[model samples]
Target: MNSELEALNSLIMTEADGLLYEKGLIRKLEKYGDVFISGSYFLQLMTWRDLDIYLASDKMNEETFFELGKEVSLCIKPAKMNYRNEFIGHTEHLPKGYYWGCYADFNTNAWKVDVWAISSKEFEQKQQEIEKLKFQINVVQRMAILKLKNSVYNHPLYRKKFFSVDIYNAVIEDNVNSEEKFKYWLQIKRGLSLN
Candidate 1:
């Protein structure tokens, strides 16, 4: 990662440890399975961005799942909260998984936190796929992915249309640069739905 991203991540980590963990929010969610953090904030080699926290648990039910979501929302006191499931439709290009998530902003920090719940099976499968792709992604390919994601001025429309997974696929499998990948993204972006 670059210096800016590293510094931002360090500060975010400190806040998560001091505020979230100390407030018992992180501890309360420990029963949800091995927590894994993803998204641009953690992976991209660019400027700082939001956080994506996924809890892999097989015990999620309709009642407790939404209840846990409410708990997380209340604990974080985010500025916005949308607890919705986007996998019900648009199954073609979307990732194969069952999840309930909240997209929220805590303050005016140019960053947000997305807390979500996904099944253990789906989580494991996605992790394995990412692990296999990690070895194939060298510095050049990683830069390509980062550049493509940053091309859209970090717009929500761009992220929904051409997510990190889409960028990874284009960079690794198609071996396309940022421009080509972006053109392809524009071609298919309209068909996708925001989660």
Candidate 2:
């Protein structure tokens, strides 16, 4: 287990010399079966040109979306010790886990032998978090529905999957003051629903 953990730490972390991972973290993983990984969506959202660029990009096809999703899930799953998200359980490419990566871009690595006697406990907790995110996704999904219901932009049909706030912002930028552009967005950060 220690060697596997050591191997994983080597594989995922950046090539920067020195211990990318803390010794204490590995010790905890040996007992906890869970270690958070940073450099997550929040970091990307804050630093990247746009929060939803990858999700909003029109260049990708259905296949690419699934692939990216799979890569992301695999990157995060081991840290959370959620093997279900490793393309092992369902055989479908959906994220069943969320592991908070580190804040620095040190490119810290993971240990393949990351074993915790209580893997099941960690997995259940991670699964609950993923479920919460799914619920949030369903709620925001209404924004896409509104775009279609009101015919707010080109390809109202295509916008069905573009549920991110960044995408809404992009559309608003493209069609300045279209009839469907609700004025309330200016006042509220999250904005309000139109009647």
Candidate 3:
């Protein structure tokens, strides 16, 4: 691993630990269901202050989920929190579950935490997918992903038009090795013009 990338990952993980452990976020979450920390944080490719947490429970209903959200709000004291009932109105490319998008200031840095309450089946499937990616990503691909992720962190098309998954596919599957190639790949493959 590149020293710079490793250093950044370590720093971000430390902050994440502060949120998950020091703030009792994980403990608070465990009261509701089994907690699984996923996305860039779990993959150790973090380039920004974003956390994706999934709670798996068979008995999670709207009321219970709202209760969980209330607990999370009190715990994080977020500046803003947006709730989404994806189970009722499922969005394409998003998990079929209840979502709580929390934006807060932690350790003097703005952070975004996405908490999803999903079924155990869905959680297992997602974990399988992540594990596959973990095995497929070699050191070269890892560095490429880290660099591309950092470069596109502030792109106009980021999150809204493209996502980290697209970057991962580009680097891992299409062998996109640089920001230039990724931009070209986006244009040709996804019809997304980054320029």
Candidate 4:
């Protein structure tokens, strides 16, 4: 990998370990079921502008979930709170009581800290899919995926694509590198562009 990309990844990991975990959010969320840093940040891919932390729960209510978000914000002291409405339209499948919130301004660079409260079953299913993809893709292909993520998939100009999962699936389905797959993926995305 390149030095710049490595530095970005290092910056993110340091924040996750130092700020979130050390501040007791990771431990606090353990009551839910399992806690993880997932999405693009978990994959250690560049172009990830935020830290995505997921709390998988066997049971939780919408109110309780939102309450947890508020507590998290209080603990993290975010500059802004990103509510559920911001993420609702982007999720492909949302489980019962699923909540999305974010903490910003914790990092000096303005990187966001997004928290997702989800169901355990859904989390496991998604992990399986990622595992399957890992089994099929080679190291270079994975790097290609990261390059695509940083260059095109997560680019500010391409607000139509919210996250990297769709792009990852596209890479697998097309069995092609990031650049080639991006061209094909762009042709079929008919969803309303958030830009």
Better of 1 and 4 by TM-score: 4
For model 4, the local distance difference test gives 0.64
Residue 23 error, candidate 1, Å: 6.2
Report the lDDT tens digits of candidate 4 across residue range 78-194: 777766732345655444435555645555656577666666876777677666766766666666676776676445646444446666766666655656556656556634243
Span of 10 residues, lowest total lDDT, candidate 3: 1-10
Q: Considering lDDT, where higher is better, how would the candidates rank from best to worst?
A: 3, 4, 1, 2
Which window of ten consecutive residues has the lowest lDDT sum in model 2? 45-54
lDDT of 2 by residue, 48-145 (tens): 11111112122333354344434433433433322222323443423323222222222343322211121345445544554454344332343442
Off by over 4 Å in 1: 1-25, 41-48, 86-100, 103-107, 153-156, 184-195
Predicted structure 2, TM vs. truth: 0.19
- Whole-model lDDT values for every prediction: 0.60, 0.32, 0.92, 0.64
TM-score quality measure for candidate 4: 0.75
Candidate 2 overall lDDT versus native: 0.32
Best by lDDT: 3
Error of 3 at 27 (Å): 0.7
C-alpha lDDT of residue 113 in model 3 = 97
In candidate 4 the C-alpha lDDT for residue 89 amounts to: 57
As for TM-score, the candidate ahead, 1 or 3, is 3
| Candidate 3 whole-model C-alpha lDDT, 0 to 1 | 0.92
lDDT per residue as tens, model 3, 1-195: 378877988898899999999999999999998999999988999989999999998888999988998999999899999999998887888999999999989999999999999999999998889888888999999999999998899987799889999999999999998999999999999999988
